[model samples]
Target chain A: MAEAREPAIRTRGLNLWYGDFQALFDVDLDIARGRVTSLIGPSGCGKSTFLRSVNRIIERLDYVRTSGSIEVMGQDVLASDVALTQLRREVGMVFQRPNPLPISVRRNVLFAHRLHNPHGQSRAEEDELVERVLREVLLWDQVKDRLDSLATGLSLEEQQKLCIARLLPVKPSVLLMDEPCSALDPEATSAVEELIWELRGDYSILIVTHNMAQARRASDECIFMLLGKVVEHAPTGDMFVTPTHSETADYIEGRYG
Target chain B: MASPGGDRSGPDHLGREWWWDKIAQVLLFGGGISAIVFIIAIFVFIAQQGLGYALVDLDLATYFTSPEWRPTSEPEPVFGALALIVGTASVTGLAMLVSVPFSIGAAIFIGEFATGRTREILKVLVELLAAIPSVVWGFIGLMVMSPLLMDVFDVSVGVSVLNAGLILGLMAAPIMTTIAEDALKAVPDGFREAAEAMGATRWQVIRQVVLPSAKNGLVAAVLLGVGRGFGETMAVLMASGHSINMPTSPLDQVRALTATIAAELGETARGSDHYRVLFSIGILLFLVTFIINLLADMFVRGKKTAR
Candidate 1:
């Protein structure tokens, strides 16, 4: 499997800081093609920070300094040759907050699709893609009736699904979600987890979650982190059942968060 | 969360406290009502005295379109307010045209692109400009602005429509920049972030997201600046040439309604056509200011929840 499978993203000696405060340090990680990897850690442990660095979103923030080499599809992402716009297009993100723009739901989903499409798509093709993505997120039935309504009026869960559906129309090769279900109830969480599982068939998915059980349920492999360091990484079942590191064991046992 | 001491009872004497509270309430309500009454009374008196001149003139052609504004013995030479209105509108329009774009651009620069020390310096400079009295601005217009304009454009008195407009535009700039900066600051950071996340450039974000979101406030600022320029007395008197003749061009000398009212109001005999003419000019000033203010209010209020 290692010989046949290629890494979609490879990070080496990654370090990030907000002013003088270090958030991520000397991290080396690999993300495989067409896999779901969940990053689980306590709050302020750099899970979301790592997720943001994947697409240079952190670069937009002031007082943030990142020193790292991130390679996606065997190209150096930080290099000038690899355009940030193109990199972002290839690697899409779903934020912690469900920020569906104060626009119609159909427009919200179709915006990402039209981003790189200079000639744009036909109306029929656009509608079909929107409907297909909405269905993939299990939101078409509920929202198909009022796709014209403002996306902000939707419930939090529905908004999150809409955000996910919005990204799907873009067809990103990698999807990074930063605690996409933390704001949701159990039923909504289950729906999102199922959607994540379904999405794994097409694209590589990296999700940051504080919910350890959610990490277990949604991910193929689990990366446990503490204090800006990766404590352990293994197959989800193996990591949860027999974590190699004592810190991972304690974290999984809920002995100490 | 109990108090450390065991003194739970409130107020030593409730009767005196309640009476004091009632007095405070009465004072507050009285102050509020007095302010409202004062504003209403001014408007009522102005309208009552000025309405006769506005309405009693039956011939629209004779009152509005007639070029002559001479007062005579018969019926006291009915003085029309149309020229005054046109003068005020024209000057205000010129001032706004010069000020709005530059002011909004200054606001965007300070609010969005400026660094720490530069932004602070610009803010302080704007406030200092606002603090300068109208008389001082007018003096600058007379001594500095007028001569510079005369040299450049070769007008007779150096005090023409252009001179008054340039001075008014300068005076209005601080107000516009400050108000527009406040409005731009009120826009949520989320809009900027959203635009940035979409791979939009810095200029694109300011244009498409921030400006549109803050459009109502910016428009209100510009309208308020127009009102300020229209009613401005000292600066207009000093720089508008005080010519009774209608303005033929920007460089040609002209008088503003505000300057006319200020220069003539004290000497004109009460209950005469001349007196009524002054009041009529006041009424025109009031109407122009009122309409602009109302438009500003509508834009500011309507745009609050437009998103």
Candidate 2:
């Protein structure tokens, strides 16, 4: 039924194992397009694993084994014929910690763009691209004069914004963020949350967060997961007011993690 | 309790502790300072002994510019080191050319691609290569490599610059591979994951992300390898034939600075001009290695500051 509605990302029978220990158990999810879907769960509840699985980054670990299907825009991303590079280009990721390359801020923004589009861009085009993305992330004016400076010199908040900006050049359909603002202070968190709110309607955003308030404040829809299974997925307001499952209610009320 | 100083008070306890502390401090300081003192003493001694002959007695211009290196001749003994310098440069250059690609490739393979049992085995093998003594490597070059080169190139003499370079490359590869692999391994997993998330291929991630992050370390590795190649003696002494001529081709028989010193140091009498000239060559080798290490240190410091 969710698939019929043309969701941005749809997963079916998604199972994952780390060596002998299974982390996910037949997880089926349908994340809608042009909406912010927040995945909230306790630690080690497979939230980050699920996000990494969507982009096939989980495969980087030699011990990780994943099963079942993940589809992005009607294409089966888990299919053997699907090129990993192609899947990744369409589905961008923001990690728990902002990992900007040690290169200059401008080069960090252009890295993925250059890799995906090897045909090359002119210097003026690169400048425009940098400006547009940095502006979109609300970081252009602060970082404009220091575009040539090393990205590692930026503040945690600016670095996280830069990380998000770097993903925009490839024009990914779905953005998977795994605790993107977990490292920031309260002020920086709100700023990043505002940026995420601004980014809605243009890209389908799936964020995993431990902060219950963040999930409620930032997301249009909230997905509550527990013990590697989805407990509830509902509108943000409805989920907070009246959770269908007791586990979701317990988690939201901070009764028990 | 009564103390030997006859103070028998709390202040006496403090005084006793301070006395022991001073002794310990002096001992530790001496231990630390001795290393620097020894290095400075060696440098001063070498300069005093060698500079008298190299700079004061002999023409400094001829020592650097003239190719003729005859130390024993009628009326005039030429101490020019131009040929030996060229020999050292060419042999080291060739060794680098042969070893750099292989070492870096092996390092990348071991550090990035290899996993599980294969990585362990390759690492052990590299360690074994490094453990092999310099003399053994020289023997291998003299017995095995020289003949192979002679047959392959159809040259009259098997021991040539090419042979020395090849053998020196083998001698240097383990050091290069081990250090370069460590450099590659030091690249954080986050960079790799970030690049992978961007849909970059494994090779692309290595080239665009990993290598750039590890650039300073890699440069340091190469500089260390160059220093190792430059200072290596036994392998070059055995395989290079020690023909004191400026090498025109890799196949030409040549003499390196290390090989020159090793071959002539024993034959020259103590405190003779020839002996002091050998000391001068040692000074040159010292300066070269020191500069390379200094450059490597700068790169390492730069990497630290950037991070």
Question: Which candidate wins on TM-score?
Answer: 2
lDDT tens per residue, model 1, B166-191: 88898999999999999999888765
User: What stretches of model 1 exceed 4 Å from their correct place?
Assistant: A1-4, A80-82, A113-115, A118-129, B1-12, B15-34, B57-63, B71-76
For B168-238, candidate 2 gives per-residue lDDT tens digits of 89889999999999889989999998888898888998998889888898899899989999999988888
Candidate No. with top DockQ: 2
Give lDDT: candidate 1, residue A26.
86
Instruction: Tell me which residue pairs clash in candidate 2.
Output: none
lDDT of 1 by residue, A1-257 (tens): 37366577788999999999999988888887899999987788898888888888888767898887888777788886767667777888887777776668998887656665757889899889989999999999999999999887899899999988887766778888989997888998898888889889698999999888888888988888889987787889999999999989988899877
- Candidate 1 pairs with clashing backbones: B72-B77
- lDDT on C-alpha atoms for all candidate structures: 0.82, 0.91
lDDT of 2 by residue, A1-257 (tens): 24456899999999999999899999999999989999998888889999999998999889999899999988999889999988988999999999998889999999889998899989999999999999999999999999999998999999999999999999999999999999999999999999999998999999999899999999999999888888888989999999999898999899877
Query: Per-candidate TM vs. native?
Result: 0.89, 0.94
